[model samples]
Target: MKKLMLGNEAIARGAYEAGVRVATAYPGTPSTEITEFAAQYDEIYAEWSPNEKVALEVAIGASFAGARAMVAMKHVGLNVAADPLFTVSYTGVNAGLVIVVADDPGMHSSQNEQDSRYYARAAQVPMLEPSDSQEALDFVKLAFDLSEEYDTPVLIRLTTRVAHSQSIVALGQRADVPLKEYRKLPEKNVMMPAMARKRHGEVERRMKALAQAANDLWINRIEMGDTSIGIIASGIAYQYAKEALPNASFLKLGMVNPLPRKLVESFARKVEKLYVIEELEPVLEEQIKSWGIAAIGKEIFPVQGELSANMIAERIAGKALDVRPAQDLPPRPPVMCPGCPHRGIYYVMQKLRLHATGDIGCYTLGALPPLKAIDTCVCMGASVGMAHGMEKARGRDFSSKLVAVIGDSTFIHSGITGLIDVVYNQGASTVVILDNSTTGMTGHQDHPGTGRTIKGDLVPPLNLINLIKAIGIRHVRVVDPFELEEVEKVLKEETQREEPSVVIAQRPCALLSKESKIPVSISEDACRLCGVCLRLGCPAIEKKPGGMYINQTLCNGCGLCVKVCKFGALRRAGE
Candidate 1:
């Protein structure tokens, strides 16, 4: 049956049908849904690992046990898992292993637009790039076959457009593939210096075999057309190229890393003008050019952001096609949700006029207008380390006044090391961990601190307060972020302390709360039209001609506005 499925979901379906037994990944955009969807299959044991490295290691172990396994993560998450990834390539898997790395070319929900294709080349792994959801599902199954055939792990590279967008995907029944028996082989499984040297040679030999396999792979096909222009493209860029120059001779590549040199040279001879149209870095273009073949790329295409059919059509046609005109989307700036727990903490930080080093999560939205609380946001788990370094350079008093804000999920990802750095280095900077239970920024995926699995299985949640105390932070305190007074008091006292301090602003996410209960509203009679409550800047609260009105539909009843209202206009239901 054909059904509309997201690229990520299609990958999950692909893995399930391919008889995958285990799936693991950390929650990151463009890649989070793959694990979430995999969890729905009873045959697959799906999980949200604490970090990307752990996720990859878990998948690696599963593959070593002779079961088909997969690991998925965003482009940056690849960096965290690179250590295990590079080694796993040396120690080929017993069962088929596939790693999905979703790249965000436009920096959408990401810190940088670093190309992940380089990772495939660096790791010396075969990579498959799918242009749409159907291909996403098909390529994953093919990746597993190729992995087992070549005795190597495979990498499936995806981008934001291909991972998040929806397309019709055909469904298939799951194959009843059983786990093979485990056998300990030191020469094959162990990565000792002597063993690794032999494996490296095997890896090089596998690359040659992979390149030969790519030469006649059905995924890499040539569409015959006008001999004057031949365009080479991969992934979503292939979709754009087809729409742009429909009649041009085409070489659409599926396995991008181990590029088919013989096929590319053969196609180059057939066409008069050879142009490679791709998004971000010219991975295929550079390789094709290196083969002593003249190709036009990058110079006629953009090196940043995403590519669209219109962009390709305009470039190839030398004029704008009769495509839909660009629509002016209203600037819907992201704001803190109504009764958001982080609002009170950010409000206090803004009131005290302190600079905050922020980490990735919903709290990063605090750097936007109205709150304007955060100063620097580098990446996941970087805030604590950056804050510690800044404090060391700026003096204790100045550093104490500064704050580092991180989320519950991020702390588990890599923030623990930074927190230990603060304790060992004796930095007086205060770190505020906003524990909202779930990984809010990435669609409420379960984390180690969430007490649940990707499939909603009950698990023990991590206690942030106890964890901080165990980290040797004597000045550890937990406060309700809705209580502004307590938040301010905690921030002020912690900043004054000479020792390292930790303040956990604990609360459920506003969106999650609303999904379980009827939203609360403002009581106009008790409201004195005071603007103090407005300081929270909730989109649910608005000023009317008569009094301040709260949109019941938007309020989550976290009661952040109630605490801010001096006149007690906001109250609980039936109060």
Candidate 2:
């Protein structure tokens, strides 16, 4: 059956048809949907791990037990799983193991545009790049086959466009391969120094064979077109280049690492001018140049952001073609939901005129507009460490004014280590954990604190307050974020304390809660037109020529504006 499928969904379908037994991942943009789609199949045991490291480890364990396994994560998530990634390279695998790392170029939903192809090269593993949804499916199946064939883990890299885009994919029936019998093969599985030394040689020899085989790999193909210019491209860049220069002869590579050197040289010899069309770093261009081949890449094009057909044509064709974004469309900026729980907390912080160190998640939106509560956001779990450093750098007066805010899932993911650092080093800072029940930023996927597994199985949720206390926090308190007075009081009390403290902003994500706050409106009679309520920046609150008004249709009546009102202008519905 042929159907339109997202690249992520197609990968899941491909894995199912290929008889993959286990799949795991921590939710991250451009990669989260892969595991979500995988859970729909009964043949696969799918899970949402606490972090990427654990996710990769789970897949590694499953593969070691002779089941074809897969793990998916965004590019930076691979950094967390790098330890296992390197060791597993030396140890090899019993069954197939494919790790999917989706790179977010253009900083769409990422902190940086660190190319993941480097990870494949660093780990000495074969890597594949898929240009569209169909290749995403086909490449995953091929990745598994290559993993088993080469006795190595395979990396299937995707970018934002390819991961989120949709295309027609021809589905296939399941090929159920029974588990390989497990034997006590210490020489192959163990990573002791002596064993690892021998395995290192095996990895080198395997790469040599794969590089030769890559020459004839079906995914890498040559299309005869204009002989004057030849383009070597892969992943989304190939799609752009094909559209940019339809008549340009092409060498499309799917297996990017352990590059087919002979094929590359052969392609270079065919055309008068050779161009390497790729995004970000010049991995291919540099490699080709090292071989004494004349290839033009980033020098002609850009080394940053998503490559567009217009961009490729403008650079290579030597003229700017008619290309412009839709000018008629209105600009829509990102904003927190009307009843977002993080909204109230940020509003409170703004009222107190305090500094905030922010972590990843929806709460990062607090850094924008009327609230503007956050100061710094580096990466997941960096806020706590940043807050402590601020205190030490500026001394007590400046540091006491700062607080670090992190989500429950993010706190568990990487913030605990920072908290440990605060306690051991005697740093006095207030850390507030927004316990909103689930991973909100990445489509509300279940996390360790949600009391449910990825597959909807009931499990005991991790207690955030108890865990904070266990970390030797003497002053720990849980405050309802909706209660403005309580939130302010707790924030004031915690920031003043001489020791490391924690304030748990206990509230479910407004979207996830069964109850909704009564939507309120502006009372015309009680209006002083002070514009204090405007500071909350709720989308429902608006200022028209007539006067200040609330869009009842959009309001959730969280009453944060009402709490901040000095003249009692804002009132509840039906009041």
Q: For every model shown, what is its TM-score relative to the native structure?
A: 0.94, 0.97
How accurate locally, in lDDT, is each candidate?
0.90, 0.91
TM-score of model number 1: 0.94
Model 2 error, position 568 (Å): 2.0
Alpha carbon deviation, residue 354, candidate 1 (Å): 1.6
Model 2, which residues run further than 4 Å from truth? 323-331
Q: Residues 1-575, candidate 2: write the lDDT tens digits.
A: 89999999999988998899999999999899999999999899999988999999999999999999999999999999999999999988989999999999998888899999999999999999999999999999999999999999999999999999999999999887799778888998888999999999999999999999999999999997989989999999999999989999999999899899999999999999999999999998999999999989988887888899988888888758565677788566688888788877888899899999999999998888888999988888999999999998998888778899999999999998899899989999899999888899889999888889878999998888788889888888888887888899999989988999998888888788777578887788898888988888788999898889899888887777888889888888766
RMSD of each: 2.4, 1.7
Error of 1 at 564 (Å): 2.5
Q: After TM-score superposition, what is the CA distance of residue 309 in candidate 2 from its true location, in Å?
A: 0.9
lDDT of 2: 0.91
For candidate 2, list the clashing residue pairs, or say none.
none
Q: Could you give candidate 1's per-residue lDDT for residues 156-221 as a string of tens digits?
A: 999999999999999999988789789998887899999999999999999998898798999999
